[model samples]
Target chain A: MNRFDYIRPGSVAEAVAAASEPGAAYLAGGTNLLDLMKIGVAAPDKVIDITRLPGLDRIDWLEDASVRIGAMVRNAELARNTAFSAAFPAISEALLSGASPQLRNAATVGGNLMQETRCAYFQDPLSRCNRRAPGSGCDALEGHNRSHAVLGWTPSCIATHPSDFCVPLAALGAIVEIEGPDGSREIDLAALHELPGSESAGGIALKHGEMITALRLPAEATSFAGHSRYLKLRERTSFAFALVSAAAMLSMEQGTITEARIALGAVAARPWHATDAETFLKGKKAEAEVFAEAAGIALKEASPSGDNAFKITLATRVLTRALTLAAKGTPDRVPALPASVFMSSEGATANA
Target chain B: MTLSISLSVNGESLNVPLEDTRTTLLDLLREHIGLTGTKKGCDRGQCGACTVLLDGKRINACLTLAASVDGTDVTTIEGLAQGDTLHPVQAAFIEHDGFQCGYCTTGQIMSAVGLLSEGDAGADPERIREGMSGNICRCAAYPGITAAVLDAERRQSESEGTSV
Candidate 1:
């Protein structure tokens, strides 16, 4: 909201050129960017609006049914896309399992990927946040650390990447198509985010003035009937940030798990890939007991904070429930169903 | 730094000159355009207080930049009612008594209009609830909002004599 020059450039070259300024940022759907600007979190000298760029909002269906989703595709569009909904339901479900309708409509894929951490201390300019202002002293490390990251977190930063879509993308190994001073390059989405404990220099992978062009996903990214669900556990259900979220993708063959890609969110600096759990679930029969065991494998070595110790237990429960429901994969449901808060509500009422 | 933008609001085109910085679509409608029907609740996207139809899609006007919409069509809550006649969504809201203080009424109505246009079937209360979750009424008039959206959907289906 501060006095800054804003330009709506039609071409990517012009937009990138404008964004190359010392203190300039590309504005997509300003749902996140403008909010930060208003709160003085992002103080850009010049704002480049590139939401109007043509061909940037496309969802290209490549050969063999692979998809290349443009960066500017709105969250709502990605959620409602029939092809994505059918093929990689996790990606579609991830997009739908985010903010409200208005926010999704105005929030672009690029903006969502670039959305800053949702740590209260980081957003509050008055508060000290290591992520916002390096070495400002992280208040959340000891102060109201309920939502702070438990895994892959260091003393420097405890903030988690507040994105639901990235979990599925990371687990599926989606490639990020980027356009910057250099030509386009398809970088692995999993490699795009960095762990705070990275001793390597240039901690963040996404460079300055390098706009996201598109996201390409393989055709066989997920099975056609692969059961997947994004179960998010939070303080409140309707519209609250996640405390512990789970994205479980199950590929079963004859009641046996062929592959299980489980990603944990809101509990780590990035989508915590449950590699051990996934490896244990492979070739095992998909059952309640197996799910419980897999969930245990996922959180066995979890290092929860003082206040966030509950997340370990909560995430285990969520993953168990998600895996159970995903295994069933039933569509028919009844309304006004008689259901316990945490109990299974299947077959509570007739569909009709 | 001033920018002149034209918007086709409510079936009418209006050219408004705005300062290069600061003013939003919400302010343009409420202050400059003098269409105060759209209530400003949170001045943020959290509350659906400034919901408006931007090219047939619902978006928080507060989050929208005025200069961004150079030649886009916008429909505010005031546009839903045609002088004396109200749209089907508006009529359903009236019949269901979907408002209280009427401050959040405009935003609720605009959101309802967009939600119904989303082509969501199943007139059940739960479906309607999930669809209209963006609109928050401090008056606790959520039941009415759900009922209105369901009622509007029902009417649309009844007119077709088939499940919509």
Candidate 2:
């Protein structure tokens, strides 16, 4: 890790001012930033610690029943919050599915949202990754691209965002509140992250010195909150990043879907919100065949690389299973494929 | 820039005057404070060998900057035992042979203690295994480790019931 100056700003204004400086990065939970620094992937000249900033660690309930979670609230705290979990079980399940109990105890909402991709090439300084160095080239495009993106990927980068929280947030239509040098603004969670389009493509759409203050989960007064699910498929049972994950929420009235929201992870540069599939599910019966059709529509635009071509089929199956589980209102059911399934020639042929 | 920070480590308040702001909590414990009980397996957060309780929450010390933890209380593996009497978690580990090489013992013990306090470790073996997944035991002492954690949790609850 490179040597740098550290400052714990007492106020959000002070933190924003410090962060606006060149080579400055906000430090909260340090779970991802510090690891990136250790690998020489990120070398910020100044790290402004924002964990101590006032009023950024509380989980508040609004009159409208919406929950406001501070940016500095640790993942463990949010996952264990009874009210938040009651309101948004998918969010709780997503948070618990990530990292470990130790890491979740320290990782914060804002830090998780701002985490860099876990693309091997992007983490390796020796590899030519366009995200690491503009116009350098992308090694993952041809070399060991099993975990590369299948959607919203450009030639400059084929990396997927490795966040479990964002997928649920996108499906739930959560809003992000950010404070910047100019003032404050709210951005829909789905619009917060951007896809890699070119060599200069950025991951997050935050302005300079803009720090995430809180995330607002809209009220679950509707039926969707009671019928939401998050399903992550990973190599191992715990402490592993997602190979393919899905978050689905549905509002059913008399066994028919009134509304549906779905998002896919580990297959795109950002959370792949299945808008087309969501539209298709509305007013349709909550059946397995309907879910399978929606899942197929969701992956219709997926363009997979050589090794990650499996993700398209994996994502479809995962999304279909997730939607079926959501319709049944089972938020904690995690369906994972065996490791041998990915290695078997028959599995590849069937998926292909 | 050298910054002076106060940290309460293992129930002792110490003022550390440091020159490098890049010093991690793991380095401060092992190198500066001379608490070798906390092992540094991976300087990064991948390995949980440097696990410690920051304000009663388990965190990877290697990923935590010492300066960022100013005015915070940290509980390390050395802090678990009172005098010569070992903590219940520590005792259970010994009773169950929870370690093979024992290099990951400190972190495993610290993480178990933290897990017990968090009330996430029930009597279920799968839950204990998942809760302790952060700490990697290269010797594959997972069965023993799981048994030790569950046993410790049972003992702690039994003692609490008796006292009540």
Candidate 3:
């Protein structure tokens, strides 16, 4: 890691003030920032350690029935909270399915949202990556990019955001609270990550000194607690990033779906919320054919960016399986392996 | 710039002066404090060879900055055993032959201890396997590792007069 002056700010205001200067970076969970620094991708002259900041590690229940989670709340703690998990089961499942237990314990909510992409080209300083250095040309475009983005991608950048927690949050329309040099503001979680345009590179939308303070889920987000599931496809059974993943949440009346929310991950620069498919599923019977049709609609606009044309088909199957599992209702307990597809069918339906 | 920080490591409180703020907790323990029990397989967060307990939670030490953990309690593999008697998880690993090259043993043992305390995974072999996935044993000693975690869980539960 590059040598730098370390500043441990006692308050959010102080932290922002220190980070507002040039060559300053806010350090939350060092899992991503330290790695980037070690690889010479990010070399900040000043490191503002915000891990000790007060009033940022809480999970507050609001009077409006919404929940406000502090940015410093660890991923492991949020997933294990009984009340939080029961109300937002899919979110908890998504959190548990990400990274490893140790990473989850140290990683924070804000850090996860701000983590850089896992593109090999972006991590390798020798490779030409436009995201890392604008106008450098992307090596992943013609190189081995079997996992590159298929949606909302441009030739300038084709890296996909590798966050499982963001998939369910995007599906539920979560809101992010931000604090910066100017003031505090809020934005929809979907708007926090920008898509690569034809001219500009894609990345987090936060300004130079802005930082995420907390995340909020509206009261109605809990309505799908009865039927919500997050399913991920990976090469390994655990401790791996997703090849394709989906979060399916539905509110049913008797045997018909009243409301539906679906989001796909690892397929785009941002979480791909299938709003059209969600609209089509309303008032329809929760059946395999209906889910298959919805899955087709979800991938209608997805085209291969490289040698990963199979991702479109694989994404469709993963979404169909996720919707099928959601229709069966969430299991009483999160599967032992979390969101892995290998979870026994019998165990999934036993709670229904 | 040098930063003076105080840390409680393995039951001992020490005031260590850091010459560089870029030092990671893994290097602080291994190089500065002379605690070589923790290994560094991958300096990045991908591997769990540098696992340690920070305030009773298992975290990757390599990714954690030494200056950031100023007042925290850290328990490393060196702290697991009391005198000559090994920790339950350590003893079970030996009984079950839970390793081949034994390079990843410290991290696997530390992660298992953290998993047991979390109480999320009980005596189920599948849960144990999932919980310990962070620590990769390249020797493919997963079967024995899973058996060891299960045995340790059962033994601890039995001693506590609880049914697994």
Note the residue pairs that clash in candidate 3.
none
Model 1 regions lying over 4 Å from their true place: A198-204, A330-352
* Two-chain DockQ for model 3: 0.72
lDDT of each residue in B31-56, candidate 2, tens digit only = 99999999999877777899999999
Comparing candidate 1 with candidate 3, which one achieves the higher lDDT? 3
- Estimate, for each residue in B29-130, the C-alpha lDDT of model 3 and write its tens digit: 999999999999988977799999999999999999999999999999999999999999999999999999999999999999999999989977778888
Q: What are the chain A TM-scores for all the models, listed individually?
A: 0.91, 0.92, 0.98
Which candidate wins on TM-score? 3
Model 1: fnat (fraction of native contacts) = 0.50
Q: What is the DockQ of each candidate?
A: 0.54, 0.55, 0.72
User: Which ranking of candidates, highest lDDT first?
Assistant: 3, 2, 1
Q: Write the per-residue lDDT of candidate 1 for residues B1-164, one digit (tens) a residue.
A: 77888989999999998875667789999899999988788876888989999999999988887878789999998888777998898898889999888888888888878877776536766556656667788998887877888888888878879785
Instruction: Report the TM-score for the A-chain of model 3.
Output: 0.98
Model 2 agreement with the true structure over A139-212: per-residue lDDT tens digits: 99889889888988888888888999889888777899999998999999878888877556557889878999
TM-score of 2: 0.94
Docking outcome class, model 2: medium
- Write down the lDDT that model 3 would get: 0.93
Please give the range of 10 consecutive residues that has the lowest summed lDDT in model 2 chain A.
Answer: A335-344
